[model samples]
Target: MAKTTKTGRPISLDSVKANQVIELLKSGHYMQTALEVAGMPRSTVYAWMNGTRAQNSRKIQDFVDTIKKANAEAEQALVQVVRTAALGYTVERVKQKFVNQQNEQGEWVPVMVEQEIIRETKRDWQAAMTILERRWPDRWGRRPPTINHEENEVTSEDLPEDFL
Candidate 1:
C-alpha cells in the first residue's frame, strides 16, 4: 500500500476510516446505514458522538471535532479584529445571550456576565456618590432636605405690618 501525507503527516488507518465515515455521512448516509456499512457496534458510534471514545470509528466525532476547531478559529479572528481596530463614531455594542441553569437549591439563575455587570454598575454608582459627598458637605450628615422656593415667596398681603 502506498502511503502519502494527508494532513501534514501520514494518515493512520483509524483516521482514514473516520474520513470515510464522514464522507458517507455528508452524502446523506443515516446512522443505521453507516452502522451497517462500517460494521461497527451502535454503542461505539454513540460513544464517539459524545467524545467518550478516543478512536474514530464513528463519523460524527470527526464532524464535531472539525466544528470545534472552526469555532475556535472564528473566535480568535473576531478577537483580533476588535483588538486591532478602534471603535468608530458609533460605539459597538453586543447583546449577550445567557442560558439559565438551576443551582443546588433548584433555583434558576442568570449567567455570570449579567451578575458581573450589575456589580460593576453598583461600584460606579457608589464612586459617584462619594464624589458628590466630597463636592457638597451635608449640614446634618443625612442628605440636605430639598426646599421649594415657591413656598417661601411672600405675597403683597403677607408683607410685614410696618410696610403695609
Candidate 2:
C-alpha cells in the first residue's frame, strides 16, 4: 500500500499521477502545465521536489531525480530539433492521385496512383548564426568595438600652433 493524503491522493513517487506528470515532462511540457494535466497540485509537487515536505524521504529523492532526468531528455530533444533546423533537411512527400484511364474493356476507369515529391529546405541563416554565436561566443558573438580615448583624442598641444 502507498501513502496517501487526507484527500486520497497518493504521495508516493510511483503513483499513476506521478508517472503521468513524468511522461508529460518527458514530452516537453512545462512543469505547471504537466502538473495541471496530471491533476496534481503544483504546490505539492514543488514541495516534494524542493524537499520542503518530505525532506529525508528516499522516495522524494527518487522523484526529484526522475523529474530531472525527464527534463534533461526534453532538453536534449529540443537541442536536436534546433540543430536540424539550423542545418536544414530534405523531406519526401507522398501523395495519392486519381487518374482516368481506359481499361481493356474499353471503359474509362479511375486509377489511384502514388506520387513522391522530394523537397529541399534551405538552411536557416539566423538559426545557424545563433548556434555559432552560442558555441563560439568569443569568435562569432557580437561585441562592441574597443576604443582608447587617450589614443584617439586630439589636444591643443598636439594640434598646429596656428590652429590653436
Candidate 3:
C-alpha cells in the first residue's frame, strides 16, 4: 500500500523485496548480488540499508548483527565438520588388490596384498585444526616465547664507552 516512485516501482523499504534482500544478505551473499537476486535496485537497497529513508539506524544495525551471527555460526560449523573428518582418519593395515606380472608372458595378474595404508582423514583433521588455530589464535594459536635474560645478562653500558 506504499506509494510508487516516478518509475512506477514501490519504495524498497516498503516493498516485500526488502525481506528477500535481507534474507539473501544473512545467508552470506554480497549486497549487490543479494539485491540483484531479489530483483531490487542498488540505489533503493542502499537507501534503506544506510538509513537514508524511512528506515532507521536501528534496523540497519539489526541487519549487521544478523550477518555477524551467521558468520560466527558458519565458522563454528566449519571447524566441527573438519574435526569430524580429521578424527576419522587412522593408519591401519588394509588388503589391496593389484595387477602384477606373474608369468613369462606379458599378461597381467591380480594379486591380493596386505599393507599399511594411511587414511586420508588425517590430512582433513590437520586442515581443520589449522583453520581453527588461525580463527582463534588466542585459544589454539602458537606464540613464540619472549625470553628475557636480564638477570644473567651482561650490560654493554658497564663496558668502557671509549673501548672502540
Best by TM-score: 2
What Cα-based lDDT does every candidate model obtain? 0.54, 0.83, 0.64
Put down candidate 2 lDDT per residue, 51-112, tens digits, no spaces.
Answer: 77744667777777999999999988977877888899777666768899999999999998
List, residue by residue over 52-155, the lDDT tens digit for candidate 3: 75644565556546545655665666667677676665655665666675766867787656555655434465776787688899999988977678865767
Instruction: Give the winner by TM-score: 1 or 3.
Output: 3
Candidate 3, residue 76: CA error in Å? Answer: 4.4
Off by over 4 Å in 2: 1-14, 93-100, 110-121, 130-164
Which candidate tops lDDT?
2
* Clashing residue pairs for model 2: none
Better of 1 and 2 by TM-score: 2
Q: CA shift at 101, candidate 1, in angstroms?
A: 84
Q: Please give the TM-score that candidate 2 achieves against the real structure.
A: 0.62
Q: Give me the runs in candidate 1 sitting further than 4 Å from their true place.
A: 1-13, 52-164
Error of 1 at 9 (Å): 26
